[model samples]
Target: MERSRYLQVALEAAHAAAEVIRHYYRDGVEVSIKADATPVTRADVESEEVIRRAISTAFPDHGFYGEETGSHALDAEYLWLVDPIDGTRSFVRGYPFFSTQIALMHRGEIVVGVSSAPAFEQIAWAERGQGAVLDGHACRISQVHALEDAAVSSGNLRTLAGGPRWADWAQVVQRVARIRGYGDFYHYHLLAAGRIDAVLESDVNILDIAALSLIVTEAGGVFTDLDGGPVTLETTSVLAGNPRIYAAVAELMRVPG
Candidate 1:
């Protein structure tokens, strides 16, 4: 695997943010509803602050787009995408699945990523051409190519039901062998670990998908938006998995004209 200084910086930032998340985890951290109706906690803000400071100190001119702090230098050639605490609901409930995700985008392409789950003591990271690692071990996606033999997961059903593609998504559920709603950062971890074949989710933000996108793809999996498009800041949905499974799911997820 190739080594990179920037990837190291991303790892350091993610680890630094993890400490803040652990401090507030299940400690009655206060939460507020954002304008988008999503929950944000003190941990989220503090964690994002930690990440921003770490990265900026290392690369002062790099842009940052964080879930809590919003965007900075959006037009800069280098952009750091941060999701301080993905699955905030799970964090508030003391669930172990929430993760801190950080990714570096160079000229609009994500080049490095880290997904650190504080409670689980697990960290997954990847750099382009460096493959991926989970908890110090090399990672790879499952080779399961057949949908009928694949275990699938999605973002919460209620969330998808309210979306325009619910009917098309349902077709995916019927085609796969098993389905679980193990939404958020954790699902990508599972996909990279070869524990599941695919994950389909809608209404995702760039911060929610950036890190996991690189991690999964580097782990020999595919990552793309719901329509089989590239995952980007404008992406509102995602369908990710091993190459074949991704193709199958994306086909099933396409809404009819």
Candidate 2:
């Protein structure tokens, strides 16, 4: 019920990865394409390890689900979701928007989340009742209710706007006020800060969306799959937006593949 300790540790883990990830990112990092066609890197792996060690030592009983090493279940009341270096593609290309995400979910609900974008020197986090915060300031979703006036974000145009799936993506963009391509998980934090209205993207893992879900929800936004279903570890596509436009946005992305 209390969020103090969990949020503290989550921020610590996220900041730890944030610091190390910065160094490897200076000259850019190497990338490896996964069997699923997703990209990973040494920076991503090492960052994941850093968070894993921090979490394990701080809360030995807490379970962990990481992007790199997969899942480690301790069967405890709490689960830590981690994305060591979210946006390995951007990181590999020397882009500055990638981040490290950490979250604490208790009994199936995400109660705490920490996302650190070291490149930007910003940290965004949330606790269920505490609301979402950017740095130390309270954050909220945009009041924009009309899609024609909304500012939107997506991970990558090439990845999300190409192939047969592009047809599904095109429909969503057509209805938005403007589409800005800012790849990586950092966009959700931006959405929580009220800087963006929504973020739709494909091909992700639990680690990618877990921390984001708490941040957005506590900030008065919604996080769900394209079809408006609850987000889960198995979900690869995501639709996140402020409450007013979430359902409308979700409906637009529901076209079957």
Candidate 3:
């Protein structure tokens, strides 16, 4: 299939999931604790189902890896990564920070992505080799090269706070002009649209960051694991930023002896 078609399908899947999420958002749903201690709701499961159906109908041969439904054919040439609701806790609390995340990974590369924040009224999409778009306008990361002039955002820092790099993280906080924990999809969106210079996170699943990673990279920013490694299925940490800020942050995050 054409790359544009992949993005089209991803957007459609995100939209379909958004409908399910919005309905549950307004009407309310019961939450259950997953074994990982994260919360899940009917909205999450039903939304994944709807997204899966939409993608399957469009390309039955492709694989699927979803937060709710789990994986199928992960090694397939083409795979769909779905996160029905990226911020369930916020959604449950009516905070409107939740979103539907959908991405297509082709031959181990995330070639397309669609992030739809229904409640937030924001949508961003990207195709590999093409630029990113946020709400119908092309977007790019900020050019703030110096740490003292850059704004950095973080998410899910529990692991970082407990690890050897805790001081390194502190160094980043002390050096940057501003720091905010805009956790979940919001920070990535901000980074991609030139609103923020960088985003760091120490605990995340592939489903959580895959789409956002593509969005950031396509927006002329770099996306990598905290170790400065390429993104892959096992990726759990992130250090994303505009090219210059990314290099600066990545160097600061290196583990100290």
TM-score (all chains, Cα) for each model: 0.94, 0.87, 0.96
Clashing pairs in 3: none
Q: Could you arrange the candidates by TM-score from highest to lowest?
A: 3, 1, 2
| For model 3, the run of ten residues with the poorest summed lDDT | 1-10
Off by over 4 Å in 1: 156-159, 255-257
* Candidate No. with top lDDT: 3
User: What TM-score does candidate 2 get on C-alpha atoms?
Assistant: 0.87
Each prediction's whole-model lDDT (CA): 0.88, 0.80, 0.90
Give one digit per residue, the lDDT tens place, for model 2 in 77-166.
Answer: 888888887777767878687888888878777788888888889888888888888888888999999888888888644556666767
Task: RMSD for all candidates, in order, please.
Answer: 1.9, 3.1, 2.0
Residue 218 lDDT in model 2? 84
Decoy 1 TM-score against native: 0.94
Query: Per-residue CA lDDT of candidate 3, range 86-166, in tens?
Result: 999998998988888898999999988888999988999999888899999999899887999999999899998898999
**Deviation (Å) of 58 in candidate 3:** 0.7
